[model samples]
Target: MHPSKVELRVLGTSVTLQEHIRKRAEQDLGIKLRFVVQDGGSVQRDGVMHPDRYELYDQWFHSIDCLWPTHALQPIELSRIRRWDEVNALPRTGRLSKAQPAGGAGCVPADRLFVQADGTLARKPSERISMLPLTHNADSFVYLPDSMPASLVEGEESWAWLLAPELAGRVALQADAAIGAIDAALAVEASGLMRFRDIGNLEIEEIDGLIGTLIEFKRRGHFAGFWSSFAEAAQLMIANKVVIQSIWSPATVELERAGLKFRLARPREGYRAWFGGIGISRLAHGRVLDAAYEYLNWWLEGWAGATMARQGFYISNPKQSRAQMSDAEWAYWYDGARASAELPGPTSKHLVPVGQVRDGGGYVARMSRIAVWDSVMDEHNYLVRRWTEFMRS
Candidate 1:
């Protein structure tokens, strides 16, 4: 942590860097830098730091951290870190330390560690996978009974249920423009199956929290509706109001344990999927760039993809998904994993399809595409402003 009197000024256009590095500095150096300003500045161009100009700032700053939102970190830091042969020679550290369950109950390690399809996990010398730790109460609690009926399984009527009738009027969806939640709602309108009523009209004694938003809807004779963050949504689902939630695979597992029935909604509706690829950055000082590249290559080679797929996540390497997973897991991720390869282009088949996705056997098929722009750094301001308008108004 920085010294109490250092009065450090940290100004950056990156949130991940701000959060991670600031916390690290506070913990390691005992210093809390007075953050003077942080804004989307002209200095950040196209989310790429120009070397000639950025090097000066790098020198002034103690450290720098940057990443591409849709993909992985850029090559700048990789290039700078590579020069430190000593850092490279140091033995690999295993995965980040696991947190003990909060309140003395043991924590169950997440079954599948989230890894990037583009091989970010492979770049590290360490063998264990990386996971973003949840900051909330980490303790495991005895949950609601897990009694999913066989009818709710593969062959049941409503097997692929999206939203339940109980949820009709009572939902508060937290949404950003990119993931297309708004479009889905519009589609529902187009289908004429359901009509939405604004929350203000609901009569409730008091509505204070997120849970209250849901309760108010149900009490006023509506199914509360709202989009949710991965962390909080998982907890809510376990408590049992969310009949169906739009979520990624990692969040999906947490809900599944709650026995609150779910299935893919519109995978083919052109939603975004987070993808990552490791690359050398111009800022990496030493041979770290080479090491990072080597690691990236290993991940793409095969085993990494297969292992990740078994965990219900898809990889850039289709062969791994096809060869490594059990038939059940494969069927879960893709309708016909082995046969998907026999189709003209294997990778293309698994990619989230754009527009309408056809019903392929039992799977909710969708094409996958990586949005190339760096929204994490460059466009977050616009997104936040829009979100504020959507919510506060």
Candidate 2:
């Protein structure tokens, strides 16, 4: 496994560490590609503490909060990426549409996109970046509307529903501290339980107050389970009878395959957004580095982006990916119009039946409504330590 072949090890979460992308990259780049896929927390930990183990890191832009501070990733030269400029304004300029304010909740991508001459990440664009922006999406909780309480109605959803006393013993949340806590904070605020000074970056007391409420809820048997992956999130609903829980897009599509009735809530408050991309390890150089750049550039040329779009993830460079998708697909997935015909996303077989519009709406509408972006708070270590009490209780 050494020397004879040009092998590139890419580390990331399940969101982008997909099998189809791996096979396609190997075929196109002519390099031995291996994706070390793990949960988001494990991926970030290994990437920061063990940079030499992988050549490229593929994960969300929020990762810069941890990886950049530790000097785990080298700057991705803007000149090296062929389609860098085509990336959408949201990640580059910090706003999806000019109508809204620049940047969204949490660690906004634009604020940390550039690597300044002084070697710090700031909003001012430079010749290099901490990560090559790739795929992204706006996420909200998913629930089975049919099984919900009469008081819980579709299109009138609220994050607070996750905390409703009626759903006790049947709710679930992701186990990750960063994401789980954000959703919990949203619920805590929405339920009139407590208000956060800053939901994205919780202070010490806020973390205590938030997690304390969650601990109480746990003791009351409000949460049915905690899921680590999309499949598990989907299964919790199917087998465990979890009627409502935080869920990813892939899991939503999987339920469509099973013919279940559900809705990815457009929470009245807004959405939790994230941007994912590739970054070279600081330890990478020579042939491995060259291959890493090749892989990064390949992600921008549209095929990989289009493939991910099928699963409801948006490519940073939307136009490039648009070319690879069919007209119906663009209409349904991007335009937010009713599907002219049957279509598929993030799966081999067709998933969307005729006349189904994408949940939330078009790209701009959904992205612009970000209530928070997935982020690591300033009190990250302490948050993790305290968050465990809620999970374990």
Candidate 3:
């Protein structure tokens, strides 16, 4: 190791840029890790516009389409990742099982993994990759059962409920268009408000139709709020300001700590999924570049993965994190078994009580049911233009 700390600036969203994670990285890697945390949209826009501002970029695979085209991020040499071969098949291939149906629609990680010689990303194997796959999860909306119009039987909760009359004026949506739009589309389709040829990549006509309907609802005061970060989303729930909303899993954990009973819907339509990882800034070099790789390798080395796993996210190298977790934690978080003891969450606090099972079952079972992924559509600019209109309206 270097005699002095090598500082690496990381530009990223709230998910991986968490304070605990930042401190841990600084401690483990013996480097100065600065996390410039922002909302997902801000991270993408900033990374694309000013990649040189940071040494490392951390976000979701969906961001590759935007960052890669601009050459904002450089390709990852997979061999540099110490546990490259240990990464699961979901990111290298589309499915966890050979018999599992294709990982449905949007920027599936496999489709963006390999970096081609033509300075492009592809599905085919190569020495270089677009991003080092890290954490991922199949996400569904959560609701306070008490606030829902009628009691929901677990596994019966539908995305349609987010738009139901009973929750009107008490519903929240994610403020960012790219991801929130997917949640909106899923709810709309589940409610029979409209249908689209491809929900992941909404065509302009579909965007208009979807936005038009949401705008009408907005006019009617259907939404309680639109949140930009996990803290904001958690506040909407913790204060009981909104009963149903799109949320990050960690926000749900916060709700639990606050003693707010909520049901993380195993939506009949299936969950909206996302995968997050790291990319070296295009301008990185020398010590900073080597430090970036160190941070990346550290992420796959189990501690960081274990940290994320505590919050309900699965790491690319599960085996690595599995070794770091307690037997009870592995069973509770991965095997779909009831907690053998009270479980600690992302933080050290033991927020998870014994006997509670994860909302969705095992890793394979939950991942297998993904309906779609957060995406960057072909008409992303147009979608942003229209999405801005929706936000303003």
Best by lDDT: 3
Candidate 2's TM-score reads: 0.97
Please give the RMSD of candidate 1 to the true structure: 16.9
Name every residue pair that clashes in candidate 2: 310-345, 310-346, 311-346
- The segments of candidate 2 whose C-alpha lies over 4 angstroms from its true place after superposition are 1-4
lDDT of candidate 3? 0.88
Query: How many clashing pairs in candidate 1?
Result: 50
Candidate 1 lDDT by residue in tens digits, 1-393: 214433333223321123433454455444443332222332233224443222112110101112223222232232323222222110112112223111110011121122345544333332233322111110001112233334333332221123334335423333433332233333342334433342111112211222233333345644334443444546556656544444434344455444444444332222332322223233433333333333334444444455444324444345434665555445545553333322211122333222222122322232211111112322334433443444443
- lDDT agreement with native, every candidate: 0.32, 0.87, 0.88
Instruction: Put down candidate 3 lDDT per residue, 243-343, tens digits, no spaces.
Output: 88988888878888899888777887888999998999989988888888989999988999899989888999899998899999999989999999999
Clashes of each: 50, 3, 0
The TM-scores of all predictions, comma-separated, are 0.41, 0.97, 0.97
Residue 135, model 3: lDDT of: 92
- Candidate 3 Cα errors over 4 Å, as ranges: 1-3, 151-155
How high is the lDDT of residue 348 in model 1?
24
Overlapping backbone residue pairs in candidate 3 total 0
Evaluation by lDDT, superior candidate among 2 and 3: 3
